[model samples]
Target: MASYLAQEVQLARRHDEILSQRSVLLQQMETHLGDKKTEKTLQMLAADAAYKRNTALLNDIEAAEKRLQAGVHLQPHPNIVKIETLYWASVEESIPKWEQFLLGRAQTPVGFKKKKSSEYNISHAKVAAQR
Candidate 1:
């Protein structure tokens, strides 16, 4: 019984650690997503909201883990919380693609016709006549 309790406590501690890492990753993702300049302002706002939601979920997970550690008997489950997976899926893959797309679009050069200089200078002629 004592061993089982100790194992449970260890598991809860591990879960807390995982949750903390996940929270950090989510925060990073939110920061990155917030920094991006999207073509559609509405999409940027929506992305911001998504980042916030992910952050909030991570926080909730951490809080739940804390409650579980404080003598709260929560249902036991395997470690399904993955920080790396979430980071890669949400931020790592998308940021590079978006950045590349933006960069590619920006690289397109704009052409403008240069104004030709007149061989005859009317202003010079006027000045010469005044002199």
Candidate 2:
């Protein structure tokens, strides 16, 4: 929320600066086409790059404002609440450690030792190991 507000303020500052520059360019455009030595004035007046950049910035600002209005940052995530609730419920029910694995409360199992089965070692695999 605070981050978006800060960006909004920054964009407004840039908007004002661009408007000031646009005014200057427009004024130059008014007197420039007939003048042979005013290439810079013509270039400045004709370039739409700045306007396009500002248009993109305006889009971002509008999106941020919409998110702000929706109060997205203040809302609790439904998934997070559900996951925490499940965890706490499991704890409260005194679920057995082994059963907790079936309930999705378990951490990853420790590494396993290699077995007589040779599926992982192709060179050692035999006829019975073949699918």
Candidate 3:
């Protein structure tokens, strides 16, 4: 019984480690994805898909650990977390800054254009002639 308990404890510790790693990766993905609507951000998200894969692996480990502890003889169902999709959405949100940085400038869509008027309008004589 003590050996079984020890195994359970080990499994739980392993699960905890995986969960921690998964959490950190998700956080990183969130940071990269937030407000980063740019091509580079998309690429970063694509790379981050690996994190999702890792998360799934961790989920599998967790399920196995649970089964081991419960002495269950059935296969556990797969995890249904949508980590990749969530990360992708985050990356979409991060686009604005990425785009601004990539474009090297910010654009004002509704601001007024400056009018280029002469300081004295031809010293006022030109206006008087027109009048």
Candidate 4:
């Protein structure tokens, strides 16, 4: 009976030790699982952000392409001739005056045809006053 009691005590102590070890293992597993879950969540968020950014960039590119296509399909200007006439008129008057002043002599001896009426000529004072 004495030997049996000693054996029972030893078994009880061993059972207690095993239970403590199991508790420690369970805590460690819980901590590891939590870390894994957090890591995966962060990875998923990063991927989602990247996907959204790429989608927006793609949308912008498509919009620009649409604008380019629309621009290409537009009709040509109807008053192209009138615009050219006006542009040349300004150039012919200004370019000769600029060249004459810079070279200290008139490059085109024939000169830019003067306006038919002096009233049409704009003086420096008149232009400055208008401004």
Query: By TM-score, who's the top model here?
Result: 4
Q: Candidate 2: which stretches are off by over 4 Å? A: 1-38, 47-52, 55-71, 77-80, 91-131
Superior candidate under lDDT, 1 versus 3: 3
Considering every candidate listed, which one attains the maximal lDDT? 4
lDDT of each: 0.75, 0.77, 0.77, 0.86
Candidate 4 shows a clash count of 0
Q: Assess every candidate by TM-score.
A: 0.28, 0.29, 0.28, 0.51
Between candidates 1 and 2, the lDDT winner: 2
Writing each residue's lDDT as its tens digit, candidate 3 over 69-124 gives: 88766545444236666778888887764677568686532333534467466657
Candidate 4: segments with Cα more than 4 A from true spot: 74-131
Tell me the alpha-carbon RMSD of every candidate: 36.4, 26.7, 34.9, 8.4
- Clash pairs (backbone) in predicted model 1: none
Q: Is candidate 2 or 4 superior in lDDT?
A: 4
Model 3: CA > 4 A from native: 38-131
lDDT (tens digit, per residue) of candidate 1 on 18-68: 999999999998887876644467787899999999999999999988987
Query: Which 10 consecutive positions of candidate 4 have the poorest summed lDDT?
Result: 106-115
Q: How many residue pairs clash in each candidate?
A: 0, 0, 11, 0
Can you write out model 2's per-residue Cα lDDT over 7-84, one digit (the tens) per residue? 999999999999999999998977676574577677776677778888999999999999898896685799999999
